[model samples]
Target: MKKFDILALGELNVDLLLNRIAGFPEVGKEIFAQDMTLTLGSSTAIFAANAATLGARVSFVGMIGKDSFGEVVRSTLEQRHVDTSNLIEVDNAATGLTAILNYDNDRANVTYPGAMSLMGVKDIRPEIIREAKHVHVSSIFLQETLHKEIFEIVRMVKDCGATLSMDVQFDPEEKWEFDYRKILPLVDVFMPNEQELMAITRKATVEEAVDVILPYANVTVVKMGTRGSLVISGGKRFHMPAMLNKSVVDAIGAGDSFDAGFISAYVRGKDLAECQRLGNLAGAVNTTAAGGTGAFSSIEAVKEAAQRYFGQTIEL
Candidate 1:
């Protein structure tokens, strides 16, 4: 029996947020931040937490060090009702962390990859793959081992009779070395932001990028922040407009939240149009709070935020 509706095979990290900085850092200069908040970080974690809040049976499979940061990652996921039984704790490295310097409407991030970069295809067990109805992986470039064995990882998950989704987040090195022809055909849903899509396809525009991948893509969803999203499958296309919020906060995990909403609806057999709309709504809601999981505290809170902020009722 499948114990989980979704298995988020992604990175686990902590966020060290620094707000109201004196000024941008210079090579030889020093500046101090006025505030600090250390919490759970990583797009996959946000997606899993929000999916759990949306009433999905979610579990996380990732590697972390047997340290305090790892403890933080485990406890926080459990608090979000995400099963962490599949988490792997390695003693060779520490948990990953991203130090975020929050500015007015933008931020600078420096990530310490740590154990998050260590998860490999060999680390994922077949029994755990059979426990989930679907699998979602994000931040391809960040995970060194996984990136090296991408095809094998996807093949393993697919062979287990579970569907697969992947959000190939920005390639930090700008190499954009992913082979779309091989990867796209295996992925049930291919999620990416506008920039990532363009980069991966080596195209200058979104249309150009879509044209290149259309041949191999099964279900492609392009997340255009503040501009909504695009849904493409077979020969049909849906352009989802953004649900703008009046009082906007930082957009830390908006895209991940969008993935959560989209996948949550998708797993429940919702049509692509509804999934795209819910994805847009969830992304909008994410910007109304401090961080990715803040606006998605619980199912009740999510419904309240949707009703009160965007005036939409969450079907879940």
Candidate 2:
């Protein structure tokens, strides 16, 4: 058996969340935030942690700095039951960080890419890829080297005979430069939220975006918050409504939580429809808590929240 069920690749950071902000910030002005929280951040890390919590054997392969922030990132992953043996530490740059100004349902973020931007194709070893049944790559734009070398990385993962999943999170520069044709063919599962999909595909709507990539993509799951998710596979389309959480703490990391739930179920050989259901359930559970991983403390915790909040039973 492979040593790990999933290997999360690319990007690692810490999130400094400022909740209940007075208003959006302006030049030469500062606003007050009622509450603050510093927690593990980055889309990939959230996926790894929550997948592990769902009982998947998850490991992380990313870059961090030799600093306190990196310590927090490492220790937190360990505490969440994710393997960290592949984390690379660099003394030249600090660990990555994002300052989030959180409002009611959404937030604005400013990130310092830091060491995460330094990891490239050379840092990833083929043997390491072979150790996992699947590999997940996220936040390509957040890491400069990873973005430049993504094609190479995806080919390597396929060569290692591991299934690949990708979540192309928001582009900080807003210039979505990914060539979905070249990359999606190598990716077994492609996960992107609605806005991100439109941005990357330059399509007017979610349907248009899916059409542009359907020829190359294997399975594409589009995350539409509260409205639910859309799944496309084998030229078939299915839409699943969200398990609405009326009282939301925050929407931070909800997409990553969905990815975690979907992938965890995927490696266990669940059907695509079931994977989408678990993903929707996990995403709803995410809003019930403060951070991306807060609601997924354990498998039991996730199942409990799934039943209590959404009135749906989750096998994981």
Candidate 3:
């Protein structure tokens, strides 16, 4: 058996969230009326933290600067019990960071790739992959220089007999025009939100988009936000409803938390329906707080919520 349940590789950063007031400010005009909060973010970091909190022995592999932000990331992961032994510190590059502005549930984010982009395929250690039951790749485009190397690493994980998963983070600046045709076949599970799926397949409907991308992987899960998620595998489709919550504070990183929940359920050999249910619970729980990972819940809490709302145990 593998020593670790999941090994996550990708970006890590601190997020500064700014709440912008309604009405855009006039060009060249200064307007100050709103609020802000500093938070931790980065797709891979959040997912790994959630997975570790959910009782998966997870390891995070990525690069960070030898700066205060890097220290914060390290401390946050340690507090969450995520393995950071494989994390590398880059000497010259600064740590990655993002500034997000939100208004009435909508948001605009400005990101700095920094040291996160410095992660290379050479940075991955084979021994880590060998010990992990599953390998997850997040924010592939941020490290544009490492696309081929990341694909190679995924292939190596397959060769080592571990399941592989990937989160497609679409950046308009860095368009995802890669040959997913070649890389998708190597993945066991492929996860993307509705918008990302639409962009990748150029399809109008979610079902159509799934049909177009299904051939590339054994299983495809498309997160549909409030409507929950759609899971397709072996030509069958299953829909899970989102857990109802009174209020939602933040939606960022909810998908990553869903990924962690789904993968954790998968590693436990849960059925497809159960996986989606747990995923929805995880996503819903995350929105109860203000930041990306602020509301990440434990496996016990997730299960209790599942039983309370869905009238089902988390068991497969």
Q: What is the C-alpha local distance difference test score of each model?
A: 0.93, 0.93, 0.81
A best-first ranking of the candidates according to their TM-score comes to: 1, 2, 3
Query: Candidate 2, residues 192-307: lDDT per residue as tens digits?
Result: 99999999999999989999999999999999998999999999999999999999987878999999989999999999999999999889999999778889888888888888
Model 3 CA deviation exceeding 4 Å by range: 19-36, 297-316
Q: Write the per-residue lDDT of candidate 3 for residues 39-149, one digit (tens) a residue.
A: 578888889988887888998888889999999889888888899898899998998999776767677778888898777767877888888999899888777545647
Per-model TM values vs. the true structure: 0.97, 0.94, 0.89
List of clashing residue pairs for candidate 2: none
Full-model lDDT, candidate 2 = 0.93
Pairs clashing in candidate 3? none
Residues 1-316 of candidate 1: C-alpha lDDT, one tens digit per residue = 6899999998999999999999898998889999999899999999999999999999999999999999999999999999999999999999999999989878999999999889999999999999999999999998999998999999999999999999989778889889999988999999999999999999999999999999999999999998899999986888978988878877878999999999999998899999898999999989988889999987888888888998999886
For candidate 2, what is the total of clashing residue pairs? 0
Off by over 4 Å in 2: 19-35, 102-108
